[model samples]
Target: MRTLLQAVLSAMLLALCITATTQANERYIVKFKEGKESAVKAALDAQGAKLALDLPKHNAAAFSLPAQALTGLSHNPNVEYVEQDAKRYLMSQTVPYGIPLVQADQVSDSVTANIKVCIIDSGYDLAHEDLSGNRVEGANDSGTGNWFTDENHHGTHVAGTIAALSNDVGVVGINPHGNLNLYIVKVFNADGWGYSSGLIAALDVCEAAGAKVINMSLGGSIKSRTEDAAFAAAETAGILSIAAAGNDGNSRYSYPASYRSVVSVAAVDENKQHADFSQYNSQVELSGPGVGVLSSVPMGTALVAATSVANHDYLAIAMEGAPTGIASGVLIDCGSGEQQCDAAGKVCLLQRGNISFADKVLACEQGGGVAAIIYNNTAGQLNGTLGTTVTAIPAVGVTADDGAAMLLDVGNDATVAIGPGNYAYFDGTSMATPHVAGVAALVWSHFPLCTNKQIRAALQQTAEDLDTAGRDNYTGFGLVQAKAAADYLALNGCTAGGGNNTCKGKHCR
Candidate 1:
C-alpha cells in the first residue's frame, strides 16, 4: 500500500499512543481543544499540515506535526495528545472471481486437505451454519483449544471466505475442502477498534500457534516495535500474512500492510476495478472482489454481505413471464426481512442462508416479481454480494442498514437508492479485502507444491490487466483469475514477478 506525505507524518506522531518503536520514519499525533477544531486545522494548514482529521468527541485535532514544531505544538494549550498515529489498514477480503471449485480442481494436482490457514481477525463462531466441521484445531476467546467464538462476526466472515465446508450446505468457501486453523487475538474491540498492545498480543498468539497463513484485517494508524517485530517475524517464519490496504481513498496506507514484509491485499470490485476505498501502489501485491462478499457470520449465521457478491451465472430462459423488454431482476437479499422489496420496484429480498441466491431469484420470478435486491444484515451499508446460478432476473444488493432504511421507508414518498456509491457504503477495507484473501487461499491451495512466493506471484502476475491497462494506482495486477493463477502455479520452477523467470503479459498467458 502507498502513503501520502501528510499521512506519513501524522501517523508517526500518533504511533506514540500505541508504542510504535520503529526508526523507519518518525510519526506524531497532536491533539487540540474541543471547540477549536477550525482554529487547529487552520493553524496546521498554515504550517503545511499534511493530513488532519477531527477526533470524534474529543474536540482534539490528531494531526501530523512537522518535525520541527513537535515540541512547540505539544506544549500549546490548544493541543492535547501529541503522539504517533499508527497506520491502520483493513484486512484483505478474498473470493473466487472466475472458475468454480470443480474447475479449479482440474487445474492443479495436490492436497490442500492438511494446510491449516490461520485467520487472525475478530474470531469465528465455529458453530456457524456455513462452517462447522470444516474448522480444524484452534485457539479463541474461550482461552482453550478447539473452542472459538466471534463476538463481532468479522472473523467469522473471514473464516468462511477462506474455508467453509464444501458439502452441499449453505455456502461453499473459496477452499471448501481446505483445513483452517483459527487463531483468536481479539485485537479489535466489539466496536472493532483496539489498542496497539492488543494487536501485538494477537500477533504473539498467531506466531506461537504455528499457523500457515495469518490474515490481519485490523490495524491502527500507527506502527509500533510491537507490530514491526511481529510482522517481520512472520516473514522470517515463512508464513504468509495477508493484510488490507486502508479504506481511505487517500494513499494513507496502514501498518503491517505497508510494513514491506506483509502481503498487502487490495479490494477489487465485481467490475474488476479497484474499489474507491482500496489503497494502491508498490505495496499492493494482488487484487480480489472485496465489496459485498458472502460468507458465514456469527452463530450458525450465514451472511449475504462481506463483499458485494457480484459473480452470477445466468440461468436459461425459464421464467413463467417469458420475459420481454424489461430486465426482470431476482436477488438473494431484498435488504429487508420481508420477501417484498421496494428499493426501485416490485422485487423479492432473498433471506440469508439455507437457500441459494439463484434459487431465491428464480422462485421470486416465478412468484411474479420484476427485480430482486440481496443485502447483508451487517452493521455497515452495502448494496449487494456475489450470487451464482440465478435465472430470469437481474440482481443488485444493499447493506443491512440501507436495506432496513429503504424497507422502513415504505409508503413514504421519499426516493431510495442504496450503494457502494459513496462513503456510507464503505465500512473500512474489510468489506473489500475478503475477496483478495479468498482468492489467494484458492490459488495457493491449487498449487500445493508452488512456493508461497510463486502462488502470490501467480495471483498478481496472471491477473487480467484492467483499470489502467498496465499496472496503475487503482487495480494492482488487475482482477485475480483462478484459472490463470492455477495454470501458472502448475508450471515447474516458477518464480513470482521479480527476477528473470517472472511471469507477465502474454508470456504469463
Candidate 2:
C-alpha cells in the first residue's frame, strides 16, 4: 500500500503543476494570516502572477510568477512563509486509554452511509470475520501487494480502529452502521514511516478517488512543499482531512498535522488525562485516547508488547510469579464489542462481539495459557464461532454458557477475571481516532450536501465538552458528540446559511 502511494504520488508530482516553473524561474509563494487574504490576492493579481491554490486559513497563496511579481505583495507586510507549499504535518497522540462509553448507543444515525474514506497508512485486514462484511471493496491502493497485508499490524490496527464494522458480531464502530467506502492508501514501508513524497501522491489519489475524509495516523518532523500542494489540492477539492498531532510531548508540531488547514488532534486517556507523549499546542484542534487502546491485529501476527489489551491483561495479572510463557493455564481475553482477538496456545477465552480464529490464540497468549478455548460473551446462545488456525496446540471455542461453567468448576475465584465475551477492554489514541472518523463519516454521509469544512466544523461544534466550558486543548472541542453532528447537519447543513466564516481557533483568535 505504501508503494502504491509512492507510485501514484510520483505520477502526480510529474503531472505538470499549474503555472509551470523550474527552480531558476523564480516563482514566489505568498502567505498571510487572519485578516490579510484578499489584499494579497488583489495585490498579486495586479502584479500579473497567476493565482494558484487560495488557502484562506493560512492566508497563503501559490503563485507561478517570478519573485519580481511579488515586489508589492512581499513588502505589503503580514505574509508568513514565502517558499513552496510545504506538506509538514502528521498525527500521533500519546495517551493510551480508550474513552469509556457508559452507554452503548452505537450511533443509530447513519451520517456516513455512502461517503468514501481513505485511510493512508498500513494495510487493512478485511478478511477478519468482524471486518469482512463491512470491508469496502477496492479499498487497497498499496501498489505493493504486501500493502494490503498489514505486516507491522499498525495499519490493520489503525484501520480497525477507524471503521471496524458496527454489526453486533464483534467490535462496535462509532457509526455502527455507517455506510462508509473504505480505501487503504499505504504511504509507509513495512517499517511504518515513509518519505513525504510517497504520502503526497496518496493525497492526490485519495482526492481523485472521491474520498471525502482522509485519516493520516502517521507523521514526521520535517516539512515538504510537495505535501503542502497535495493538502491544498484536497482542500480545494473539498475533502475534509484529519491528522494526528505527533507523539512528542512538546508544543512544537509535526507536518501535515500542523498544517493550518488540516485538523490537528491530541490524545487523552480514558480517565481524560492528557497523554504525556501527546504534543501540547495552541493549534491542537481536538483530542482522544492515544494510550493503550485495544484494536484489531493482523491475522497471523502477535500484537507487540505495547498493545492496550496487553496492558489490560497486565492490570488483572495474577501471575503466580513472573513465570515465562504459560504452558498449561486457562486464560481469558475480555472484549465487549465484535473484535477479532486471535491468540494461540491454551485455554483461550473470547469476550463479547464477533470471534475470529486469531481471537482464541491471542487470548491464550495474553492470559499465559498453553492450549486455547474461546466463548461468546453475548447474551444469546453464542455458538462460539470465531476465526482460528489449526495448530500443534489444541484449540477450541465455546459459548459463554459453557466457558463460565468450566471456569467456575476448574478455576479459583481470587482474581478479577472478566468472564467469557467478545468485547475486550482496551485503550489508546488509535482507538479514539476511529470514533471521530466514524462520526465524521456519519455526518458527512447523511448530509452529502455539507462541505468538508462544514463536516469538520460540525464535529468540532458538537464534540461533547470533556474539559473546559467551551474548547480547550486537553479535550479540544470535547468528546466526539455524534448526535450533535447529526442535529447540526440536519439543522445547519440542511438550509445553507451563507457560511460560518469563522477563523481557525488559534493563538491570534
Candidate 3:
C-alpha cells in the first residue's frame, strides 16, 4: 500500500511539472482597475511574471505568466480583465518594381482627374481586394460571361496594373490615387482568344464610355482591315490605344499592335533589357517592365508557395499545376528523384535534370513523400512546370545556392506551404502594355488640355533611350518615363512647340 501511494505521488508531480512548463510560455494582457496599476504591477512582479509591455493609457500590462497564476489574477479585485496576446499583422501596401522603374512613383498622388482608361480582354475580377475601391465600371462584348467576372484572369491582372486601389494590402497600381476611372470591355472568352470583330465592338464601347486611354494586352499574327479601321477611328476620336507587341520572340508583326494608330509596347525585364520572348519589329514603339511582373489576380486564385529549413525562409516558386497544401517533415535527399528511395513521410529534396519536373514529383509521391523540392542544376532559380501531369503532393523549386544550403540540413525539419493568394507573377508583353496605358492616363490626368496626339508625342520624346541610340525596332523610344513626360508637358505645354497648358480648378478632366 505504501509503494502504490508513492507511485501516485510521483505521477501527480510529473503532471504538475508539464502543466507549469506549458503555461509559463503563454503571453497575455492584464488590464487593471483604475488607481490599481502600481499595486497590480507590484503583485505581478512578486510572482515572477515576465512583463513585456506597459500600457498606462489603457490601464493594462502585457506579461508571460503561469496559467494557475493567471487564473488567480483574474479573480483579483484589482484586475479588470485578462486576455491572450494575439498577433497583429501590418496592413501595408507593396509597390511593384515596375512602379518606380517607369518613374510613376515620383509623380504626385494628390492630383485627381476622372480620366477614363478602358481595358479590353478577358473581363475583370471586380471583387479583388486591391481593385474593389476604384471607380471601376464595365461592359461585356464577348458573350462568354459578365464583364465584372474574370474567367481567364488576364483582364483582372491588366486592370490591377492600371488602377489597383492604394489600399493597405496586396499591391499598389500606377494610378492608385483613385483619380482615374476604369472601364473594362470583355472581348476575350475564358479560353483567352477572341475575334477581331469582338475587339472592334469593344473599341466602340470604349468610345461610348468616354475612355481616353485603351489597353489591349492581346494580339495575333493576322491583320484585318476592319480592325485597323476601328482602331484608327478610335484614335481619331481622341483615344490613346495601346497593345502588346506579341511574344513570338521574332521580328514578326502582330495586329492590332501592328496597326498604325496603336502604341506597340514591348516587354523588358527589371534590368531594363529586352525580353527574349518580346517581339521586335519596326512597329515596336515603346518598352515596359513585363518579365516577372507581379500584380493582382482573382482573390484566392493565385498560387503562392514557400519553403523553410532550420527556421530560415528560402525563395521558392511553386511548380505549375502542383497541388495546394502544407506539409512539414524531415528533409531527405533524393538525387534527381528518378528512382526515389526511402522518402516515406518526408520531403524529398531532388536535383534538377534527368526527367521532367512532373515525373520527378510523381516519383516522390509514389514513394510516400509529403512534398518535393527541386533545386536548379544551373546558376539561376528553377521556375519549372508540371505540364499535364497531376500530383497529390506540393512541389517547389529553388535556386542552386539555396538548394546547396538546404542540402546541408538534410536530416532537419523543413516545411513547404502552397496556397491560393491574391497576386501572381506573369511574363509577356501582355504584361507590359498595361504599364504604358496606366502611365498614359497618369500623364494625361495632369495635362487634361493635351490632345491625344500631344500626349503620344510627349511620351515618345521623353522616353529613356536604350538599344541603338534614338528609335530602334526592338525598343523604339526605349522605356516610357512618367515623370519625364509630365515634366516635359509642364515646360513645353500641350503642343511640341511649347504653350502654357496647365489644368485649371476642379474641372481638370
Number of the top-ranking candidate, with lDDT as the measure: 3
Where does candidate 1 stray beyond 4 Å?
1-110, 141-147, 178-185, 300-428, 445-450, 495-509
**Which residues of candidate 3, in runs, are more than 4 Å off?**
1-89, 377-381, 497-509
Candidate 3 local lDDT, residue 263: 97
lDDT per residue for candidate 2 within 303-405, as digits (tens), equals: 1110011212212211111111212332444343144334332244445454454554445545444444444564322222223343333333334665566
Question: What TM-score, to 2 decimals, does candidate 3 have?
Answer: 0.79
* Cα lDDT of model 1 by residue, 64-149, tens digit: 56554555566667766676665553322233332242133343323454455666666667666557676465554333223366
The best-first sequence of candidates by lDDT reads 3, 2, 1
> TM-scores, in order shown?
0.53, 0.56, 0.79
Candidate 1 vs candidate 3: which has greater lDDT?
3
For candidate 1, what's the RMSD? 25.2
Over 1-509, each residue of candidate 3 has an lDDT whose tens digit, in order, gives 00000001111111221111123436789999999988888888777787899888998989988656776797789998988775343555677889999998988755536589999988889888888888889988746789999978888888888888887777788999787788998887778888888889889999999999999999999999999999999888889999999999999999999899999999888888898889999999999988767788777666677787876778677787887777777899999988965888888999999899999999999998988999999765567788899899989888899999999999887877676667777778988999999999898888788878888988999999988899999998999999998887777677561334454323333
Over 4 Å off, model 2: 1-106, 109-111, 138-144, 166-169, 303-324, 327-428, 494-509
Tell me, what's the RMSD of every candidate?
25.2, 29.6, 11.9
Which pairs clash inside model 3?
none
